[model samples]
Target: MSKTTITANGQTKNLSLEPRRLLADVLREDFRLSGVHIGCAHGACGACTVHVDGVPRLSCLTFAVQCDGAEINTVESLGGDDAHHLLQRAFREEHGLQCGYCTPGFLMTMAPYVEEMAAQDRMPEDAEIRHAMSGNICRCTGYQSIVAAVRLAITQRRNGESTQ
Candidate 1:
């Protein structure tokens, strides 16, 4: 087993894992962070999405050993007493989730895109937003509400709110 240290949700954690162990397995089994679901064990589905060094990646396709020294964040870390991220609040207010299975991945992926949109002072054009979110698929909500929620969060962000 290889030893790996990762900062998850702002907390440092250490674990022993096989070099070939999938990140999804290590996260759910060793860390007991069941919120990181494994959907398509292949990389096709975004269900196992997580942020590694602030970039979204498919956890199922990533090796635990490869995550050594990485900073990871999951949807579990997306909210706080300081405030709910604008995306989280928008999702709730806009009813962005149906069964909610894909919500976490959507949030993880969109967070960065939203920041880019604000930084560029360009409202994410529909094509850009769609392309950015194409990797994640939602079976239950038909994607309408999800897109709406993202748009709502963008508006809130443009109005001077920090969603991250």
Candidate 2:
């Protein structure tokens, strides 16, 4: 067993795990982050996306040993203990999720994009949103609602409004 240290969602833990274990397994099974869904398990589905060192990456494709000292942010870090984040609220308002299997990936992948746009106070076109979200595949509905959610979140953030 390899002794690895991973800081997840603001909590740091030292673990002794197999060298070949996937980061998704460590996050879900060890960290108890159930939101890290395993869809496709080949990194194509994007259902296991999470932020490692402030960048979105496919957890399923990453080995836990590779992230020995990395800071990982899962979906749990988005909202407060009792409140939803702006993107999450926008998603719910716009009905961006149906089956919800792919929501976590989409959230992790798009959070930075939306935050960047909001920081610039820029409204993104659907094409730009589509381009940013191209890496994530949502098999449930068309991309319209997801795009709408991104737009809504951008707007809400730019205006400094909280959905709570």
Q: Model 2, which residues run further than 4 Å from truth?
A: 80-83, 162-164
**Prediction 2 global C-alpha lDDT:** 0.91
Best of the candidates, TM-score: 2
TM-score of each: 0.92, 0.94
- Off-target runs (Cα >4 Å) in candidate 1 are 80-83
Give the per-residue lDDT of model 2 (tens digit) for 1-164: 99999999988999999999999999999999988989998868889999999999999999998999999999888985542988998888899999999999999999999889988999988999999988788987698999999999999888998644
State each model's CA lDDT, in order: 0.83, 0.91
Q: Say which candidate scores most in lDDT.
A: 2
